[model samples]
Target: MHIAPLSPDDPSELGGYELLGRIGQGGMGQVYLGESPGGEPAAVKVIKPSIVDSETRLRFAQEVEILKTIWGARIAALLDADPEADPPWLATEYVEGLDLSRHVASHGPLDALLTASLGATLAEALATVHKQGLLHRDLKPANVLLGPNGPKVIDFGLAVFAESSVSLTAANTVVGTPSCMPPEQANGEKPLTPAVDVYALGAVLLFASTGHAPYRADNIHLLFHQVVDASIAPDLSGAPEELVPLLTAMLAHRPQDRPALDDVIRRCRALIEARGLKVAQARRRLTNFTAAPAHVLDDLLAVDRPATPGSTARARAGAADVPPGQGESEPEMLAPEAAQQEPGGFRPDRQEPEPPHTPPMPPAPVPRPTDPRLLFARIDTPTPPPAGTTTDEAAVKPDRSRPSARPAPRGGTGTGGGSSAPRRSLRHSAQARITAQRLREAYAANSPF
Candidate 1:
């Protein structure tokens, strides 16, 4: 939502690369999209001149040293850096595709399989860093890039070591954002440990699967109190059921109670596979599929199910037809003939004709459901929390980041003596299944990086 004005620095003066545009800016510096000398896309973060004081200079040098050791780790790799220079810079491998924040907002919560895969990918990356005696202090959505390969963590500007008294703070430095920062950090606890990052990753995952932040507030003061109270339960209505336990483990109030990064990776990967989605390749297989289990959400059950069909062409087109110079030639050539009148039909041409430019067809309307459960059920994986661990909100931690309690199941209980929780009502059909498969193929082959 923030916009920035263009910087007029000469590209050649900085290095032998072309500057594309300014992408973002923060406390550290401005991030510009540029190309490497050899033509690789790169993101260059130029440190602000004011941070050249001895304190900021020393921290930048330390970052360079640590990053050089963990060069090719899962997230993004540092391509170049010059901590000694004025307006110091750290250029990293540029990742294409939307950030996790933008992607979720645009596409709805990702399908359960994709969400689970994201957790595994991140845990794996974090483990790599943790194993190297490094801790990624900033683990929020803006720092996690969603490339075609899956998710990759980036920006180690604020990362610290496993055991180092020299904190990254000096003179009123607020290390991280309030809503996602761990309770210890929010309480001015310096010399932060790895658990801080662990807790942050939990909040980020919650945001990825649900649209809201776990600890949002009007201001940082109240947000810090919420973190201290440990009162928030993530809004997990759309998250896979299997993820509930994993999230619980990650978001444990005490840092000592959180699972190691390795465990996090293993559990997330297991969830994805358990839901019948392949991690390596998610292409369509031998047959089309749908899951209409007996118990269903009231809204979903109310839907007038469309008959199974071999093609969606007879049903409706999804997007507006592109004109001649826009896409393939065939669709344009066929339009006039297809729009022509048939002989003995109830053609409204007899009464009056619509504007020739107007098409006879309207794009299929994708109506959003009122029920959040139905919307999230679009994701196929279930988030099965470990049996009998009460998720009561009132008994939250000293920090009160708990979300509101949802409505009880219909009739103040669920159907057939089953547990009183929402069940994902999957509504895949043959035609839609084929469409999804083709999309997967297109996504796989288009990995430019």
Candidate 2:
């Protein structure tokens, strides 16, 4: 919700739109608050040049085509786009409000009526996407904007052509946040169906109702396993009793077990009707509930420009009440290799303020070696003499007397290569023993023995 001032490196203009500031940093690009020539406010999302490869361009173009087909009140409409631009950029109606994730984090969880109304509107929006043969592969709470009008689902960066002919990302490349990922996605299933989004929406609604995802883990790898394992049921302890049954169906492990979008909308409507309110009345209630804080922003950006349709002026104001340093945490991106094996990692309910600029990807986790000898052998350290063996029996000194022979070829062993192999083996064995002893001592304090 915070609108950070544009940095020196950020372009002041893109595709003729005047860039105001940054709305938020995403995996593929930076979203800027921009003003069109006609004075209409737009959310301009430009692909980072560093990431603009041929495949990425193709994907962006496909997304543009998909967006062209999508039109819904609950979804942000695509305003303009230039897929052939230097880095390629697209603009959508800027929904000025807080993301559901940060809103729930700063304020407490929403009541049942509000949660049900949000779920129904979002489900209808997704239904439109599915009707066009598109799937919003990433549907977390952060992607839903609590705008002045109502909840509008934004960020289609991870959307995919759900039909048989197209695949946007590479094979086995895992995308989407860990906490909200469906079992099929977590297990690397291809040609995903609309049910994946249904499962994610369940996670989003759960967070809206209870302030946490169904699953939690110490690291991304463990979270992936929890999501994929059928034996592990989601922890639904804190969910509202009325909503638990619907959340359970939507969060089902198997795609077939989950309800279709229409069914989901039906159930959500039923919940609202039970509260003695029509769907429209409940939606207005939701709009009023979330829009209360946005009024404060009328003065903050008053001088920028008069409000237009879906202006970004209200975003910073709606989020103004969130205490400094209490914003939602940035999602963890799982590398391709990690995706196939461990899937991904995530933090639940933690707050990390968004950096003013996009941050570089963090280094991958270090692989733990199973064999100490293999680890020690890779390093060029000298091998010590073995226990109970004197230097005369074990030490092999390279002769400094002779002119040092030309360094060995890439894979060739040097002079005395055969002898060196045996010495190296002995050294590795000795080092392995020492490492084992040290490790045992270091862990002895916690050992049952």
TM-score of every prediction relative to native? 0.61, 0.66
Please list the residue runs of candidate 1 whose C-alpha ends up more than 4 Å from where it truly belongs after superposition. 1-5, 9-13, 171-173, 231-238, 282-449
Instruction: Estimate, for each residue in 1-449, the C-alpha lDDT of model 2 and write its tens digit.
Output: 45556788999899889887777886789888888888788999999999999888988998788788888888899999999999799999988767888667655688898899999999999999898888998899989988868998887777887866356667777878989999998887877999999999999999999989989999999999999999999988789999999999999999999999999999999999998889987887677556422221222234322111111122222233334323222222221111112211211222322221223333233333444333332222224344575544432332223221111111112111111110112222223344456546546644668
Residue 125 error, candidate 1, Å: 0.3
**lDDT winner:** 2
Estimate the lDDT of model 1. Answer: 0.54
- The whole-model lDDT of each prediction reads 0.54, 0.68
lDDT by residue for model 1 (7-44), tens: 45523234544555566778877777666767676777
In model 1, what lDDT does residue 433 have? 48
